[model samples]
Target: MVDRLEQSKALASQARLSVLGWLADPQAHFAHQVTGPPAEIGVCVTLLAARLEMAQPTVSRHLEVLRRAGFVTVRRIGKWAYFQRNEAALADYKAWINDHL
Candidate 1:
């Protein structure tokens, strides 16, 4: 069904930009962060960049991509920008795609 295909495509889009991928690969992308959550903690851009050994601007670009794809939500806390998994949105997207596709 066209609808099903659309649903799958939407989720695929999200997965392509998942913050989960970064969280899943903490050693690779989470090492450089100064003070960040563990695997149990949500990944933040600054921490992620530190872990990834990348520049803040670069990490921000990646985070922006994920945020746009509906994979993560960014909230500014004081002077820090915290990124969290959009679990509810992701779950809803998965369920819709599963039901339709």
Candidate 2:
């Protein structure tokens, strides 16, 4: 209960919300990768950092927050980390929001 409230509060940041929006439509928000499309796996941290116009470390910290909030999921392909939205988690979050507030 209290923990859920705390988790919800953690996602209140503008940066985290923006990250979720980009992830919502990876193909639309992100560009195609040399290896493949962002939709195939997930958007790479480098691309996300570039799009956000923030330092890699800063973007990474935002991603970490989203990941902890269950709004994003991470996959590592070699040295790079890719991120995708967790639709189920988002749906759950939405429901929680509706119920709580």
Candidate 3:
């Protein structure tokens, strides 16, 4: 598990926060994917890149930070990597915020 400071650093970026917000309601934010259900398997990186209007590599770099910080979880399907918010980690972060600041 990542420390709170690490997670905090990951969220410092607006793009990363946007990714988390979108994943919070994947079905509404992202288009239905042929790879799998958005809510179940998570949203594809391609969709995220398109939605963010950024290059895939750039979006991927943001996602990698979140992944390392445990703010999001990834599921690999063939060549694609899907992502969703780590709700448990999020709850812990929220609780920490409520307790500390």
Candidate 4:
């Protein structure tokens, strides 16, 4: 349907894909946080921005695309936004690709 097509389009960007890959292994990809852990809440947006070597706004836009595609989930802790991969959504995406392509 149109929604699925739109979701597919949302994931078509390289930056979004990189975000997903980084989120896949948060512990390995990101540094340890004093607040707690990367796996507990999720990786912080600032950390993601630093790792990607892009501005926070640019990283945020890429995160938004991945979020719309249902590939990432968001958590708000205090004043920061954390992001992590959505395993179920990713599984669904893979299945859809297998079936449609």
Candidate 5:
């Protein structure tokens, strides 16, 4: 019983942390259309920086946080780097939390 509780506690903490990480960078961590509706893919670093009125390096640091947490993925095209949510991993994590908690 103790072990099970401990495991659940750990998982709950991790799930909470992951959600925080995913939202850490609303612009850099997500992609959507500038107007009208949101896009299927996330935004690139340059675009995110423009939207946030921040520097590329600053946005980069936030992206690193999300990437390390397994909440986002990065892709490079030329000199630009794009980020997208790892939907599968996030979905699985949410499912686990919903089941255990």
Candidate 6:
């Protein structure tokens, strides 16, 4: 389960919000991946790093924050890890926002 405060903190970061926005429309934001489908398996950390023009480790840390916040889900294919939006969680978060603030 995700803590509401942690999730709110995750949403406060521009980098992390950018990640979520991109993942929300992976096909348009990201190039077609060879390892797996962008929507199905999500975009690779390396690809996200390149797109964000940031270091892989930095992107990974951002992803870790989002993952812990329940805004994204990660799947490992061999050595590569792909990240996709957790749509249900996102909807729930949105509803929570509506109800709270």
The clash count of every prediction, one per candidate, is: 6, 0, 0, 0, 2, 0
List residue ranges in candidate 4 displaced over 4 A: none
**TM-score per candidate, chains pooled:** 0.56, 0.89, 0.94, 0.90, 0.55, 0.94
Query: Candidate 4, residues 30-67: lDDT per residue as tens digits?
Result: 75766668887889999888888899999998888788
Quick one: RMSD of model 1?
A: 5.4
After superposing candidate 5 on the true structure, give the runs of residues whose Cα lies further than 4 Å from its correct spot: 1-42
CA lDDT of each candidate?
A: 0.61, 0.82, 0.91, 0.84, 0.56, 0.90
* Tens digits of lDDT, candidate 1, 23-90: 65655666555556444445566666665667889778767766665656777756777776777766
Candidates 3 and 4 compared: the better one by TM-score is 3
Badly placed stretches (over 4 Å) of model 3 are none
Model 4 poorest 10 in a row by lDDT: 1-10
Tens-place lDDT per residue, model 3, 1-101, is 55888888998999998999999999888756778789999999999999999999999999999999888999998899999999998998999989998
Q: Compared to the true structure, candidate 5 yields what TM-score?
A: 0.55
| Model 6 misplaced regions, further than 4 Å | none
lDDT by residue (tens digit), candidate 5, 1-101: 12333333433444334434544554444535353112334456666666566788876776676666565677765666667767675676677669978
C-alpha positional error of residue 101 in candidate 2 after TM-score superposition, expressed in Å: 2.1
Candidate order by decreasing lDDT: 3, 6, 4, 2, 1, 5
Winning candidate number (lDDT): 3
lDDT of 2 by residue, 5-86 (tens): 6567668788778878888888888766665578878999988899888999999988887787777899998998999998
Instruction: Give lDDT tens digits, candidate 6, residues 1-101.
Output: 65999999999988898999999889898756777679878999999999889999999999999999999999998999999999999999999999998
